[model samples]
Structures are given as structure tokens and as C-alpha cells.
Target: MSNLEIRDLHVTVETEAGTKEILKGVDLTINSGETHAIMGPNGSGKSTLAYSIAGHPKYTITQGSVTLDGEDILGLTVDERARAGLFLAMQYPVEVPGVSVSNFLRTAKTAIDGQAPKLRTWARDVNTAMERVDMDPEMANRSLNEGFSGGEKKRHEIVQLELLNPKFAILDETDSGLDIDALRIVSDGVNRYSAQGDRGVLLITHYTRILRYIKPDHVHVFVAGRVAEQGGAELAERLEAEGYDRYVKAARAGV
Candidate 1:
């Protein structure tokens, strides 16, 4: 099975003041067939870890290494990381005004696979994936996420996940703006993809709601950019009951 490993990852970004470290020293490992959930409060660096692994330009890896199957990916470009079997579902999917959803998916799939898929089969696969996510087939001809609702944008992200079938998927708060029905549909799509038993998922979120539909094997509490606690499904239940207050207090007290 493949493995996505992060080692003492420290990420920073430039602001008006100066370089500020978002990830202090984070370490986590997600193997194929496993789903790990990162739960934390706001400004705790959950999304920073996701973007860092995806090789986003805005975040700089000041120290630490991220590797896929023992190959360091810090040196790879954003597209190179994707080609290496990494995918990131942004917390806020941006609008691509001119790029039609169908064309965008096809182009991304072609880029990751290193060849253009046969048109007839590609079209069918796209439709099938979109259907799985309850996305309107007609919307495929529209600009990517340009006029879509929050739920639609999130569903479109899942469509990409289904079509691209990356080795690892880093979902950054995919459950944020989705309603109950939409949440279940999106969760089902994720489950279908992970059921292949050869893919890894690192889902970052602020709440445990999504965990009900997408159960993670491991639950980690991120506090002040570091993993404060690790446990099983029970941990999520505890978080739901107790909240992150204790974790936040502990971090503040330097516990």
C-alpha cells in the first residue's frame, strides 16, 4: 500500500508584518486504505497542513518533509504533486469563469494520467461521477463553479476526486457549507472512492458531523499547529461532547 508521510512539517506564509509560521511542527502518516481526520478550532493550522502537502505556492515549507511512498515531494511543483497522486479539495473552491466543468475535469484527468482519454469513454465517466455526486449533467457545460451553489461546488470537487482517483485526497473542510442531504451525498461519493481499498484520505474539518458519514480510522486534534492528541473514533465522540476548549486551554498553558 502507498503511504503519505509528513515529518515535523513547519509551514509559513508572508504577511504585511513578516513571515509567520502556521504549522509549528506537525507529523502524521496516512496509508492507503486509511482515513485520518484532523479536527481543530479556527486558526489552528488545519488547512495550512493540507495546502502545504498539496504544494500550494502561498505556503512555504520552511522545514520538514512531505513524502509519498518515501519520495520527498517538497521539491515538486503543484501539478507535479498531483501527477504524483496527490489531490486537494480546497475549503473554498474558486470560480473558473471561462473553463467549462467538463473541459476542466478532462484536462485535469489527462494531465494526471499523462494521456488524453478516449472522448466517448471520458464523457461517460464524467457523467457517471457527476451523477454519483448528484450534480446536474447540464451543469457540466457551464463554467467551473462559476454560478454553482456552495453545495454544488463541493460536489464538483468530489466529481474530480472520482474521476482523477488520486492515491491520496486531502479534503479541507469539505463539509463546511453543505446541508444534511448534500453532506450525505458527498460523503457517499467519498466512501465509494475509498472503498477501492487503495486510497488514503486526510480530511480536515472543524466539526465531527462529517465523521458520522465518513468514519476515520484515526482522529487527531490539532492545537497551536501541533497534534495534541490522537485516538480512535471514540475521540471524535469525545470532541463532539467536550469540544476543543480543553485542548485550547492546554495549548495556551503550554501543556
Candidate 2:
């Protein structure tokens, strides 16, 4: 099925005081070629869920499981999960001072493929990936995400998406901190990547504006770390009109 299944998962972060449970018995599944939007207020554990799935070290999965195509992925390492066909577009991508864009992308492409592409042939494809994302070919020579505009960094992420071609992508607030034109460019690249066959997208956003461009097949309201409600595209419209108070209350009641 090439689908991702997150089954009754609970997450807790360790601290000096003790463990604090964040996600409480969350169950969700997404199949290929579909886009699912996760909308939530702040501190609802939306990003926590995204990072946990991507195998970040801080958040720990205390119970339940996550799987890709029925294979348990909870045991895999961060890079191992990437190689297993999962991608996370962070809200704030890091800046590496010395690493060039081409170098970073080449390493990622190599890791995804599990072997290096021929050096001569690889150079041509890297430029092609840049062009597809509307990135300047000259930027490829600059250090990774260093001294770039907000839009530039976001577009670079899309270039990685095109090059990596992961089966499932969790976009964690990709639309945040962007201007109108930048938002359009970022959404365009996201749409292009989502067009591929059997590629699933799980987009996390606080605003519904980006949904207009990407047109999610389904929309989910995440409250206190679990999906409070789920419906089709119309759900997004309702959220835009009314806001999240009603859903948050319902979620608090365990409805």
C-alpha cells in the first residue's frame, strides 16, 4: 500500500522533573497520492508529532508504533527513516556556513539512493533540480541556507524534495514566515512535488491560506497532540470561517 500508519502513539519528553505525556493515543493513517492537512493552535504537539515521526532525538515515543508499508519504523534512526522514504520540511531550516548547496544536495541525493550517482552525471541533475524549484543556478555555488532570503531557504527545501523524492512528506509550517510572493513560490514547488504518483503529503499549518494553493484531499484538526476531527476540503473552509475554539473544546472533552 505504501502508506504510513501511526497507531495509538504516545510521546513524552524527558526532563529533570519527570516525563510529560504529550500525544495521547493518536491513531492516523495516510496512503499514497493523498494530501492531509493538520491544523492546530499553538502547543498542540503538531510539530512534536512531525519530529517524532522523522526520528528526532528529543521527543520519545513511549507507546504504540509508526510504520511505513506495514514495516515498523519506530526502531529506525533519523537518517534511516529518511532512507526508508520519509521527509520533513522543517519550519526553520538550519544554516550551514561552510557547506555549499550543491554539496548538501548531493549528499542528500546520495543517501536517498543508498549509493552515489556517477560524479559526472550527478552534476547535470543537480542543476536540473535547482531549475525545477526556480532557484538561481548561481546559488548552488553558495553555502547551504547561509545568507539567503526567507523565500530562498524555503525554495531550497523544495529542491531537496524534488531530488530526494520521498514517499511521504511532513511539511511543518512551511508557509510560516513568508511573504506573498514567497508563499506562492513555496506552494508551487510543493504542488509540483505532490503531483507525483502515490506520493502522500501531511502538511501542518496554523492558517488555511496555503490550502487554497495546495488543495488538500483531507483536513485534520490536531488538538493536544491527537487528531480531534477530520473531513474533506470543506473542513478547511469551515476552519477559516470560524476558527479553532470549537474543535479545541470538543477535543478537551475527549469527543
Candidate 3:
């Protein structure tokens, strides 16, 4: 069985208006070395699902449970979840104006690893990860994502993914706003992390372009607030050709 499981999960967010239901009910299981692609329309609860999985405080679990290896994780804090080997590379990576990339990475790595990586070797690891993402090693000394281009921000997330080595990762729309070359570099970095063989990935995207490079073991079409269809990699190609018209209609009809 795959380690990560979400069973009939429902989530709500406390917005200024009130508690807003985001994830109606989501069920999915991901195992080692498997990639699952979640394709959904905007506001279809894709990012919400990722955040709920990562134990984001803003997302309240109204029902169901998320378990890793048999232990329920709904009660875990964000940092606790991270230490349990769960990661979410957000669609929008925020910049820290004063913290250098190297400092942020060092802090994050130590937190995730539960101990500091060897000081001398940490720099080497950071440089290698940066190079894999096509980033200059010099960028490591710059403030984290400060004034970085969209592609640069996304690449920085992949760099963190590499250094943290999380067992399970939800890549929330990491392919957005990338040019062809940037897309290729980001995909390569994702592949590098998946090469670990025991790692699981939930890749959330609106378009299937990234799937062409990093094929998914399964593809799910999420419409409205729930999953509408699912299949193997070929499902992604079908959606690319036909668009989401039929699936959205199907979701409406079912609703």
C-alpha cells in the first residue's frame, strides 16, 4: 500500500465572510515511486487539497482523516507534518526580503532533518541542487526569492525539495508561468527528486504540459469541488485534446 492516504476528507477555510467549504470530500492514495496528476479548473479545490494534506492551519478538517503509514496526521502541526516527511511546493512562493537563500535553505534543511547537515557538505549540496535547477550558485547568497522571476521562484522550490528530501511531496501548480526552457529545468528537478524510488508525488496542474515530461501513473480530473474522472497516463492526453468541457458538465449533472 502507498504510504499516504486521504479518506473522505472535507476541509473549510475561515475567510472574512465566514467558514468557507473548500474541499467537499477528497479521497486519494499515493504510494512509493508513483506520480499522480491532479488536473482541475481554477477554484476547484486543488490547492486547498494540498494545503489540507500538509496540515495548513487555515484549512480546517471538518471530517475524515489523512494518514501516513497507518498514523492519522490530521492533528499534526505544519512543522510536525514536515518532519513526518510531507512537503508542499506552493503555486506561489513568497519572497523573504532579508533572508538569504543560503540561510533559508540551511534553516529549512536543519528543521526537516531534525539536525544540522554537516556544515562543510551542506554548501556542496546546496550548490549541486541549484545547478540542477539551472540557477547560478551565486544566487544562493541573494535573499530568498527576493525580486526573482516567476520561473526562478519555482526553481527555488525545487531546490528546497531536493535538499529536504521529503518522502511525499505535493507540487501545487509548480509548472505555472514557466517558459519552455524553464519548464524543462523544473521538470528535470522534479524527476531528480522522484528518482529516490521510495518517494511519492502528487503533481497538481491545470494543464497537462508537464505530464509530457514527467508521466503520471494516474491522472484525475477534478471539476467543481470533486474528482470527475480518473485513469492512467492516457487520460491526460485525452483531456488535453478535448478540454474539460465534458468533465465539468458531468460534474454539474452529478451534482
- Predicted structure with the largest TM-score when compared to the true one: 1
User: Could you tell which candidate, 2 or 3, scores higher by lDDT?
Assistant: 3
Worst 10 residues of 3 by lDDT: 246-255
The lDDT values for all models are 0.94, 0.89, 0.90
Model 2 weakest lDDT span, ten residues long: 125-134
lDDT of 3 by residue, 1-255 (tens): 348998888888888999898877788899989999999888889999998898777888899889998888888889999999899999999989999999999999889887989989999999999998889999999999998999999999999999998989899999999999999999998998898899999999999899989989999888766778899999999988999988777877875
Name the top lDDT candidate.
1
RMSD of each: 0.7, 1.5, 1.3
TM-score of 1: 0.99
> Candidate 2 lDDT, tens digit per residue, 108-164?
888889788888887787888777767888899999999988778888888888789
Compared with the true structure, the alpha-carbon lDDT of candidate 3 equals: 0.90
Q: Indicate the worst ten consecutive residues by lDDT in candidate 1.
A: 127-136
As for model 3, its CA RMSD to the true structure in angstroms is 1.3
lDDT for each residue of candidate 1 in 1-255, tens digit (9 for 90 to 100): 999999999999999999999999998999999999999999999998988898889998889999999999999999999999999999999999999998999899989999999999999999888888888799999999998999999999999999999999999999999999999999998999899999999999999999999999999999999999999999999999999999999999999
Candidate 2, residue 24: Cα displacement in angstroms equals 0.9
Candidate 3 residue-pair clash tally: 1
